[model samples]
Target: MSPTAAPTLRVERSLLRAGHGLVAGVDEVGRGALAGPVSVGVLVVGPHTPAAPRGLRDSKLLTPAAREALVPALRDWAAAWAVGHAEPAEIDALGITAALRLAGRRALAQLAEPPAAVLLDGSHDWLSDPPGQALPGLGEPVLPCAAPPVTTRVKADTTCAAVAGASVLAKTARDALMARRHEEHPHYGWAANKGYGAPEHLAAVAEHGRCSQHRLSWRLPAAALPPAPRGARAADTLQPPVGPGPGRGARGA
Candidate 1:
């Protein structure tokens, strides 16, 4: 597709026509990273116009340059957009699943107008809150009486244009943050790996041990450690059985 060609933006329009005026798409990024925060972005598309760009797809499929290029266009075409994040501490404490929901809730709360309903990328199970438990750091009234229900689906990013837009925003925003972090800790090669547990990253861990930035909970297994050198048995050796006959008789019995 030509750089100038706008990507298709149909998902939100169809919902709008169906009487859902304030439909919003939600997506999160960095769920798999060993470090860094999880970011959730919420976006609402305005009335369909030729000015709206096309070429929407899962953010993973787009390059950094492509995503960067699309960000401004998305902001321009979108009726509204907001991003929320769960910090590394939160991810480490609450886990990725809970972090995702927290980020989503924060993002939605930032929106100027509450959406009639939310289109969350992936399954509804993702948003399952602990029954009657207040959301951490959100204070009392965790589930606002006025908030609308959310809808989620697998591959929602690809099938739903609004979700795709949210993906772009979340991915681009998280990428930028990772890039910034890369400047601070270049030794881990975070810029290239984006905090993923790549082989190089594992090697880095073995060489440097764990850093303050690393999630201590994700330490490499003992097998991942470098192999011991040949003929280097430790002085601590098990003594052989002194009474072999007794052992043999016991075994026979």
Candidate 2:
């Protein structure tokens, strides 16, 4: 879709006609952050749902202020909406994919009714549970209801109104959370970077070491500098890998 184009309900309307009374749009945020929780937002729409706000688009395409402004309208537009998060520790224990499922299920659980069908932004069906697969650290099913069938669309966040709204809600919610976390640990610069691989946040990790909020399983910045020389002991280094780090050419915050 063009950058200036607005998302439409065409895709959603199609699903509503496919014998599904309720259709949900699903999206995630903070999956790549060095700290903070991975969040998922679910927005349910039904046959009578209205068009989205005029400027609604993918969260990545909208500015922070624009996204913040759309939240109230988006929330009011949906039949039901909810946001959920999997903390850094959960990410470490269950890994990102499982964490995303956990967060998505949590959001779905908050809805007044389970969606008859789910419309996911990405091409991968990450939200559905594998057959006979047990919940890892969580130990129990996130929802008592049967899992709803999901349909994945690449770039749906940009093409689908409901998906875009979900992205905005998830992004704004996670940003607020990281901003609050920044108040307690000012050095991470989370208020601005939102815990992505921003240079300053990496530098802070390199200097102060990983804190409780950091995903300990992921490679973080080293706590100290390299060894003084051959005669000196080598300083400690972090083990978790930064998926896209400074050396790898950093991605957006």
Candidate 3:
């Protein structure tokens, strides 16, 4: 399907027909960001689900205003929805692939019940456990319930309405998070760049060194980073939230 075309429930409906009573569409945001948490969104739709509201598409195609505008409609349309995040520290401790799975599992855990099956946007099933390679203390059976069957589709965010809705929810929540964090570290311009490696962001990292929000394990720019100012929280001291709410009270969306 064309990227600009409105997403349809054709794929989700097919899953319903195949006997999956509750199908969850899954997508993630901020996976490539230089700071802040990686977020995953799950939007569950059943056979009774209605058509998506107008103007819905992949989150990347929508303006910030447009994505924020659709939040209410998207929430109303889905049987259930939730967004989950894995902090930068978690990303640095576990690899990005494992961090994505961690975030995805957290999202799935917020649902009223586990989905019968999951429709993931990308080709890789980053939502599932790594089989025998599970990391100690952080991996192996991290899923809240038994892992649901997953079906990965390339470009599912553009072609599948449910997955597209998931992307929208995830993007809005994560963007709001970065915007709020911008208040604490305005030099990085996270409010504008959303923690992606914008030129100004890279320059700030070079000048001021990494902050508590930056993923320390990532290959950051090679520059002499100064020590944190006196009384400033160290980058490694921040802790991840134990809950699924992605700072809902601070949401700018």
Candidate 4:
């Protein structure tokens, strides 16, 4: 397929034909957000999987309204699904790489049953022997692990129904969390940007400084980032909340 088109479940079907009973399509959201935590979503789909709700595509492709409308149906269509998040403190403490592993582990642990294989979006295996650094176009992973095998593909979220489902779930869950947080910190305008680095969000950070929920390790607005230490390598000094998050406070549609 071309680089710009939406995806299908053909890859999931192929894996099913290979005798995989339950392949979980996994995807992540909010990894690039300037605030809030990262979220991972898992959706299990197999040969007998029900059709995804109509008009469901990559969560990034769908409008907030469309994603909101489809959230319940996606939850019902998957045999099993769950969303896991790594709070900003975890992200600051472990850096994004390990934090992602932590989040993915949490999501997988919530599954009703272990997946036969995990169909992860993107070309890098973020959950396998070799973790994906920046999701570079490294093909499938080769290392073995206690967990089920992982199959990574670029644009899997677009081409695989299971992965797409996971994307929607993660996006929806993360958005809900941001909306909830917005109630407490309306200055960030998270209700509109969902914690992304929108202009208003940057302005708020510049004016109000970072919150407990902001990732201290991530680059923030110019005024928010601490000045580089003199004679220190041009790298970060990494260090390490669920409130207003998805555990239970946020309402899902």
Summarize candidate 3's per-residue lDDT along 64-96 as a digit string, tens digits: 999999999999999999999989888877767
Give the per-residue lDDT of model 4 (tens digit) for 25-125. 99998877778888999999877886667887888888989888988898888889999888888777656665666678778877778889899887666
What candidate 3 gets wrong by more than 4 Å, as runs, is 134-143, 222-253
Clashing pairs in 3: none
Per-residue lDDT, model 1, residue 54, is 61
Residue ranges of candidate 4 with Cα displaced over 4 Å:
2-6, 129-146, 223-253
Model 2 poorest ten-residue lDDT run: 244-253
TM-score ranking, high to low? 2, 3, 4, 1
Provide the overall lDDT of each model, using Cα atoms, as 2-decimal numbers.
0.67, 0.82, 0.83, 0.76
Whichever of 3 and 4 has more lDDT, that candidate is 3
The list of candidate 2 runs beyond 4 A from truth reads 137-146, 221-241, 244-253
lDDT tens string, model 2, 53-164?
8789999999999999999999999999999898887787777777788888888888888999999987777788878864564655434233499999988889999898
| Preferred candidate (lDDT higher): 2 or 3 | 3
For candidate 2, what's the RMSD?
Answer: 4.2
TM-scores for all candidates: the values are 0.76, 0.87, 0.85, 0.80
Model 4 has an lDDT value of: 0.76
* Per-residue lDDT of 130 in model 4: 52
Total clashing residue pairs per candidate?
A: 7, 3, 0, 6
Q: Superposing all C-alpha atoms, what RMSD in Å does each candidate have to the true structure?
A: 11.9, 4.2, 8.5, 9.3
Candidate 2 lands at a TM-score of: 0.87
